[model samples]
Target: MFVGHGLGAFALVAFLATVAGCSRERAIQLGIVAGLFAFVPDVDIVYAPIGLLARSVQTVSPDVFWGTANTVHRGATHSIVIGAILAAAVAAWNIPARVSRIAAVGGFLSIIAIGAVVDGLVNAGVLVVYVATGLAIGEWARRKRSSTGWLFGAALIGLVSHPFGDLFTGGPADFLYPFDIVLVTSRIALHPDPTVHLLAVFLLELGTIWLAIVAYTRLQRISIRRLLRPRAVAGSGYAAAVFVIPTPTIHTAPLFVFSILALAIVGVGIPAHPFARHRRSETLVTGLAAVTVGAIAYAAAYGTLG
Candidate 1:
């Protein structure tokens, strides 16, 4: 899901940019900027280490560690209001240097101030890191000389779309933070059965990654379908895992995830020739296709048996 966030943003923005008449190189650059910004909200995960270090016992289970660390995971950073402000600040970088500095500083401080008022100083400290990350990405876009409108659009789309993706996996994000409004109260259920729901989400994530891959190939003027190999079909064998592993839910999915992902080994059977120009790319495309096939096969088996 973490990688899905960045890649999803990249795919959407890059495709839109291409359709909007941007040069291929310019579209790719804008997409990269948006993809980076899409990762800013999750920076709250950084709190995991700090929490672990402060504990009397050094070790904790995965659930305990994540629970402790994610206290502020979907807070102010996910807010559309906050995202808009950051986008504006980033876009301002195209203006005079002094005004740009003022906008960036002012936007950063304003977010911290809101966080302090709403969630307390500790969470506000987290906001500081988050704001810095957004600004750093904005600065990078500025250096790339991205147009003001394009920069703002990329930032806004990337930051804002992130929260929606979360709704499908866990608790809803605070879409309107510091305002005491709850837009969504629960995770969006894709299926009635827990195992099926988890599988659905997993397939959705794989689809997103594939979309990003297609977008990349388009930018490089390559045909993704042609790069894939017959070995990918071997992934269908993963359906056998349905009979062996315990049923998986969103909360307990490591076994299912790991087992299905192991099918990626099928992609390694590439040309051994040293002079094969597209060998690396072919292997990667083949691997992704394998994983995609495996997940679908597993889902179909689970649906039939369970």
Candidate 2:
């Protein structure tokens, strides 16, 4: 859910919106908005920097990337109701285009600022001042129209999608602000969780990646095979690496993961022929990738874990 939230998530959403109505080029532009806004909710992490330099940090963790102000990681902006409000506001107002530009800039800076906190590289109240300055300037921009549907759509997609991405990584999103309602509850355990049952989460991420690829490629008239190749190669390659890695202690049986992976690869091949008509290479590559996943999972099972 790391890159899944940023690049893959926003891009996939942008691609889908493009297919919905807007022109491809316009959709791409809106995608820029989606990508930026997707990170906006996390901007509150700026408080992490403010606290550290002031030596009176408002947040407990100071782990800005995951920290929040006066509350938890998923705060107000992460709220669905809040996001809806923001999105609606974006649609309803004819604000200066610069507001978005500065917001996007600040949003990314905020992420970087959070990273700095995580790395412990920040001090002297400098980072706090820096981000604050940027945001402040962004707020003072010039204004335009509310008739365009693009802003609303982009805002809605970006704002709403951000929380769902968090579900696969951390706690559930608080969709209803001030009501204490958790919109998403299941954060299916995965590898990083220090558990043996990593298959479910891994498969979920794999499936998410696949969905993004399939949906976007189809929408853009890009052959699905085009997107699948590199992924298969990469998966197969990683499988190869894992298959040869040194063993670790307390490994759990990953046979099921491998078996399912192998089956999935062959499945990809079967579907390719009907879709692309005699595209044997596509099936072969996919099948090979599947074998790779199977091989990796099988070997990994015997390697290490709790």
Candidate 3:
């Protein structure tokens, strides 16, 4: 759920960057909505006891809140069908005349997906019920009104990625929903390499700061766009290695260090290269810089070989 939320937020930023023009106020608004929406699905714990109590009264059995909460994955709320239906209903009632239909669709889908993720998979049990409830409320009150395809796409990506992120961290989101098979991690973990973990953490922090700077500059209309292609290059390198490396391990300090350096070098070189002819140079540069940090972190966890 944590990883999914972060990705969703990142997706929101990317989508906003393209559509909303990436203003500070808009970013803040998106952040707030994303945070609330991300956790909206897990609100089902409130109903577990109710169901249990009802059963107990009807069948002369005892009810346990914890037990009720610990079970129940995807019954109704988590399904894409239900999500769409609920989203449509909400839109019918709440959408403003001035807002774009696309933005409203995106927002509704995003929240509904969040509910599904939280209820059905991200956190196991009766959480789905609560998520459905939240979805109902959120749908009723929803009004931000982006109503665009880009927004919905971003939100959808975030919703889908949430459980995948949790799989890596060994979270129960995968098991939260009994039938769905989504495994992911938050990408933050105890490094397979101790030294690399520490180093990677530091580099990630720096990268975050750098990204903030770039975003701020963009808001200020500064032309010094960040580079991102280098990150793509690093990703390519990593993909290539996956096939070549016989044994898989996260303790790749050398790879992390080298990737970082490669990203940095590439990032610095981008400005002078012909590829930098575009107006969004700063965006690319920032992306590359961030990739460099990712490489560093990977190296810390799984030291590079050769």
Q: Name the TM-score of candidate 2.
A: 0.52
Pick the TM-score winner. Answer: 1
**What is the per-residue lDDT of model 1 for residues 1-306, given as tens digits with 9 covering 90 to 100?**
788889999999999999999999998999999899899889888887788777738568888788877788888888888888888877876566896778867877888999898889978888889888887898788888888899989999999989999987888998998788899999999998899899899989999998998998989899987888998999998888888988889998988888888887777784575236757788778888999998889889987886
Model 1 segments beyond 4 Å from truth?
Answer: 270-277
> Tens digit of lDDT per residue, candidate 3, span 1-306?
333344344545544654656555566445444434444444544556666766575543223554564454323333343334434533443544545446545544554465456554433334334435434544433555544343343333333434343333222444223345543324556566545444545455455445544554555466552334434454334434334434333344344445444554444444455344563564445555556545554453355542
lDDT of 2 at 1: 50
Q: Candidate 1, TM-score vs. the true structure?
A: 0.94
Candidate 2: segments with Cα more than 4 A from true spot: 7-21, 54-72, 95-147, 180-199, 214-306
Candidate 2 C-alpha lDDT tens digits along 194-256: 333344445455565555545445545667555345445434334344445442211332443
Clashes of each: 0, 3, 48
What are the C-alpha RMSDs, in order, of all predicted structures?
1.9, 10.4, 13.1
- Residue 74 local lDDT, model 3: 28
Candidate 2 lDDT (Cα, 0 to 1): 0.51
